[model samples]
Target: MLEGPEIHRALTRIAHEVLERTKGAEDVTLLGIPSRGAPLARRLAERIERVESRTVPCGALDITMYRDDLHLAPARALGRTEIPPEGIDGRVVVLVDDVLFSGRTVRAALDALNDLGRPRSVQLAVLVDRGHRELPIRADYVGKNLPTSLRESVTVLLEESDGVDAVLIGPKRERGEDRTDEARTASGEEN
Candidate 1:
């Protein structure tokens, strides 16, 4: 798990990279892909503002409807998206997310952005860029490059929810490893 100082360091590095690549955040807007990304985007925006002395608009996007696996979960709550008062037109947009694994979330974010407005360019920024992409999407600014297997899940717990900001890599349990126990639990069986 990453400590607060480590997370701050990574965000600082990413901010510098973004500023260097985009030549500053003069005409840039930070758009976070809902939930976790929203806070991350806000944090990055602050870093950019302090470094460049320019305020960049930070917005949250809800792409649940655009997800490829929409049917897997129950209905998702929509988030408020406040693009700069000027909107995303002709601006350099940086999409922020926690972990980049399968690239499906990024894909969904792109689809959602299309309805908002056409930006000058869109770049991705993520904390962890774990290998095992189901699509071709890649992050422009990555905090850490963690090579992981397909059966592992990287979870980011924020201070707001988990009372701490940390990254954890959880290995998925193998199939049939505890089927009997799982079934018993489901059936309300005692130990």
Candidate 2:
């Protein structure tokens, strides 16, 4: 789990890295992968503004339909993808996400970006990087590098979603075993 101070420091460092790599925030835009990624993008945008004295357009992108596993989870809800009024045409687009898991979401995001407009360049930023990538995607900016097993789940609680923003490594459970019973029993109940 990352403390608020740690997150702040990471954002500051990422801003510096972005500025250094892009040679300032000119012609730069932030596109957060919807849901958890939105707030992170907004925070990054705010930090960038503080450093550059200019508002970098922060947009949200929803890639639910574009995901390869959509058919597997048809009932899943979607997120919002808001592009800047100027659009992403000929601009550098940086995609933000909470956790980099299988890299499939990033691939879907790339497809979604292509549908929007031809970007001069596209980069990735993530809060946490867990291994087991099913694709070749890599984050341009990362907050932390965590080595986790495939069975373990990484839960990121943002201030918006959770009272406080922190990353947690949830306990791993065995496959085909129902842990709901354990949860219910711990709550003094049975189902």
Candidate 3:
């Protein structure tokens, strides 16, 4: 699992990689998935600005309404979507997220983005890419390539919300299993 310093380093590296991949961040919009990614997007934009001296557009996008598993998944609060003033049309939009698991979220994000506008190009950037992607989607820029089991869950605790920065990985209990206990960080010791 990733710690505070680790997460910071990853984002710094990711920001540089994004600029390199997009060729100087021109017409680029960093659209982050709701919750964790929104803050991460702002951090990435700041890092990019340090190098380029020009600010890159940042926005928050929520895919709850566009998800395909609504019928099966539990109901949750819908998140707000805020697009940048520049919009996504004719720009390079990089979708940012904390973790990549089954890739369903990215799929939903793609749909949500399509409804917003047709970007000249879209790319993906994630802090962690845990294997077992149910969809064919893959991240273009990844901070870390983490491997996790289907029975395990990866929760990214950002300082913005959790008050501490760390990645928690633990057994994912089913409906009948006990869910009272807390999860632990993997720390890349025992995946």
Against the true structure, whose TM-score is highest? 3
Identify the runs in model 1 with alpha carbons over 4 angstroms from their true place.
173-191
| Clashes, model 1 | 0
Q: Quickly count the clashes in candidate 3.
A: 2
TM-score (C-alpha, index-matched) for candidate 3:
0.89
lDDT of 1 at 121: 95
Q: Write the per-residue lDDT of candidate 1 for residues 1-191, one digit (tens) a residue.
A: 57788888999999999999998777889998656788889999999999988888989887767877657544445656667687999999999988887788888889988998999999999988877777989999999887777667566766754577888777765433443423211111100
Candidate 3: regions farther than 4 A off: 175-191
Indicate whether candidate 1 or candidate 2 has the larger lDDT.
2
Residue 139 error for model 2, in Å? 0.7
For each candidate, the alpha-carbon lDDT, in order, equals 0.77, 0.77, 0.80
Pairwise TM-score winner, candidates 1 and 2: 2
lDDT of 2 by residue, 37-79 (tens): 8888999999999998998999999887787755543234556
RMSD of 3: 4.3
> What does candidate 2 score on TM?
0.88
- Measured against the true structure, the TM-scores of the candidates, in listed sequence, are 0.86, 0.88, 0.89
